[model samples]
Target: MNPFTYARAENAHDAFALGSQPGAKYLGGGTNLVDLMRETIERPVTLVDVTGLSCEIEERAGGGLLVGAAVRNTALASHLAVRTRYPMLARAVSSGASAQIRNMATVAGNTLQRTRCAYFYDDEGSRCNKRNPGQGCDAVDGFNRYHAILGASPGCVATHPSDMCVALAALDAVVHLQNARGERTLPFIDLHRLPEDRPEIETLLEPGELITAIELPPLAFGARSTYRKVRDRSSYAFALVSVAVALELDGDTVKDVRMALGGVAHKPWRAWKAEEALRGKPATAESFRAAAEAELAHAQPLRGNAFKVELAKRTLTAVLAELKEVKV
Candidate 1:
């Protein structure tokens, strides 16, 4: 690891000031950033600790929730309102990493976590465009069983690794950000960028900007939501394919739905096409299967990860079928 100066900021003002310095990075829980630093993938001259900032989970005035960026993953997953009102988010958080890591991982850190592509992490042996722009991406033609099938470009085939993000995407969560200039909000789905030619750039965040909170809009069907993850292992494993969905049915007819996919794209893929196809359609296995096909119609699978297309389709159909049977 590189020699670095560390400073703890107790408030947002202090965080912003310190974070604006040259080669400075805001530290939330240091779950992902610290590892990247150790691997020499991220080298910052200074670390501005922001874990002391807002950690509250406040209910919005009308409805919804405002989750502080510093809120720990365990806390967020266990919050009464989250577990009861937004079960998908809770389940997704619980499905990530392990209990120890979850205890230390913050909401913002998880939101900003980088991809876990093996090629991207092998700093010395592999050529990763995401690690160094225009250098080339080994994962594209390498062992790509876990690579992206959607929104992947010639420069990079990496998949975003956050399960929490999939649920956030489905919930239509908004990210609250602040920098030296001012504050702004971005839709959660728009936060991450697909790896195009410039695979190095990940999120759309402005330089030195800090994530303050994530706001989840009110969805009456949120309580009916669930998250399902399929991985090579039972625990401490990233999803090979994951689905987060919120379903609302009116007597076997789809009234409303929201769905997002993980481990198959550069970012959490909001299944807008599938949702569009399902509305007003009968809540049957055939309709669910057709919706899944519509969503994956444009998916361009890689050599090793082509099975993901069928896996995604089957998982989407099964999840919807399971939700359809639930008494709502």
Candidate 2:
């Protein structure tokens, strides 16, 4: 790790001021940042510790929930309200990393995690566009079995590696941010940018901008939601393809649907086209297949990840079928 100055931020104002400095980074749980530092992938000159700030979960007006950015992943997953209402979110968080890491990883840290692409992590290599812009992406031609199949550009083919983010996207969450300029809110869908021309610029956050909390809007079918992940291993493995489905059904017809996919794009892939096709439609296998196919029709798969297209469809179908069977 590089020699760096450390400062503890007293509040959001202090944290943003320190973070806006050149070569400074805000530290929450230090889960992902610490690993990148050791690998020499990230070498900040200063670290502004923000974990001490009041990071508590609060109930918002109108039956929503405001989750502090510094809340631990384990605590957020096991919270009584979260487990009882947004079970898909709880399941998604629990499905990721080991128990110890979850206990130490913060909610905001998980939202801002780097991709698990091997090329991006190879600091010694000179072919990762995400790590070195305009250097060219080695994963495009190299072993890219886990690379993205949707919303990818020639500059980068990597995918975001957060299971929690997929659920948040489906729940229509809003991200609250604070910076030296002031405060602002962004929809969770807009938080992550596509790896289009600038793969290095991952999130919409400007320099020194700190995520204060995330607000999940009142949901109708959260209890009927489900998350299904497909990976090489059953435990402690990154997703090959994952689906989060939060559906509200009216008898046999779909009343409303929120869906998002992981491991298939540069950000949490919201299946808005799929949702449009399913809303007011019968909740049957044929309807599910058509909706899934509609969203996947835009996928541009590389040589190694063509199988993801079919896998994603089946995962969507399975999740919707199970969610439909649950008594509302």
Write candidate 1's Cα lDDT for 154-195 as tens digits.
Answer: 999999999999999999999999887788999999999998
lDDT of 1 at 177: 91
| Candidate 2 per-residue lDDT over residues 1-328, each given as its tens digit | 8999999998888888888999998898898999999998999999999887657889988778999988999999999988878989999999999999999999999999999999999888649989988999999989999999999999999999999999999999999999767999999999999999999999999887999899989896788998888999999999999999999988899999999999999999999999999999999999999999999999999999999999999999999999988976
Clashes of 2: 0
Which pairs clash (backbone N, Cα, C closer than 3 Å) in model 2? none
